[model samples]
Target: MVRYAFSKIGMTSTFTTNGSAQGVTVLKMQPARVLRHETLENGKVVVVVEYDTGHKNKLVRGWVVDNPAEYQVGSPLKAPSLNAGQKLKITGFSKGRGFQDAMTRHGFGGGPASHGSRFHRSPGSVGMRAEPGRVMKGKKMPGQDGNVQVTLRNVQVAYWSTEESVMAIVGGVPGARGGIVFV
Candidate 1:
C-alpha cells in the first residue's frame, strides 16, 4: 500500500554515502489534518487532508488509501515512516517561466541568423493555404511554460529523520525550493 504525505521542498545539497558524494533534495513534511473520509465504489478509501501553507491559507489534498479506519477526521494525519534507500514518487509543480517564445519554449529552429533573414526567433510556416485555412489545433506554439504538475518516480531516499520530519531524497526534485510536494 502507498502512503501519501504533503511536504515542502527544502534545499538541495550533497551527502556522503558509501564513500561517494550524491546529490540530494531535502523535504520538510507538513502537518496535515484529516477533514473527512470517503469510500469509493471500488472499495478504495480517500481521505481529505488540510495543510497549513504558512501563508495564512490552507491547502487541501485528497489521498487514496487501502484502509480508512487508520485515519480519524479532525485529527492530524500520521507521517509516513520511510527508510533510507526506499524508492519514492514525488509530485509537484515545476518552476513557472511565464510567456516564453517559440524558440525558447518549443525549441523551434528558425531560418537564418547572420544576413538579416528576419526569422531569427519566430515560428515559421504555421499554416497551409485554403485547404486547411487556419492553424491546426494542438500546434506547438509559444505560451505558458512550466507551473504544471510533474512527478518523479524511483527517487531513492538518501536520508530520513522521523523526529524532525525531514527527508532527503537522492537526485533532483521538481518545482522551486519551499514549494509544496506530495509523496
Candidate 2:
C-alpha cells in the first residue's frame, strides 16, 4: 500500500456477526430535546438535540418528520402510540436499483430471445402515434428505480421492545438494512 503525504489514512474497524440480519432502523427516545439544527454534509440537516438537562448532546438523523421548525428546545417530543400485535403502515425508501428497464422496472413481458424477433426485454411501442400527439404522462418507461418512499400497508407487528426501541414486523419491509423506516 502506498501512502500519500497530503492525505492522512486511517484504519476502519469492522466486526463480523453471525446472528446479524437485516435489522430495521431502531430509534431510541433518550430524552433528547431538540436544540438547534444545521444543514451539513450529504444534504443531511443535523439536528443538534440535547438531553439530560443539556449536559449531553446528540445529533438526530433519519427522522420521518423533516421540518426542523417543528422541534424546539424545552419542549417534549410527542412520540406516536405504538403497541405490538397491531397492524401498522411502514413507510420507507426501498432499495435503490438506480436506472432500470421495463422488464425489471415495470415488469413488461418482452419479445422472445430467439432468432429474428430481436425485441427481447424491450418496452414495445411507448409512442401513442398521432391520436394524442404525445405519450401519456404516467408512462412506465426506463428510468430511476427504487429509493422512493413506498408504504407497506397492513404490516402486522410481530414484536415491539420499548427497552430496545425496535419493532419487528411480520413479513418483509422496504429499504436496505439500516435504512430509515418510519412506522
* Candidate 1, residue 154: lDDT: 92
Judge candidate 2 at residue 122 and give its lDDT: 85
TM-score of 2: 0.58
For 17-70, candidate 1 gives per-residue lDDT tens digits of 557778788888888788998788988888888887676888887878877787
Provide the global lDDT of candidate 2 against the true structure. Answer: 0.56
Q: Write the per-residue lDDT of candidate 2 for residues 119-153, one digit (tens) a residue.
A: 99889987777898888989889999988888879
Best by TM-score: 1
Residue 72 alpha-carbon offset, candidate 2, angstroms: 7.9
Q: Candidate 1's C-alpha lDDT?
A: 0.81
Error of 1 at 59 (Å): 0.8
The regions of model 2 sitting more than 4 angstroms off are 1-32, 36-81
Clash pairs (backbone) in predicted model 2: none
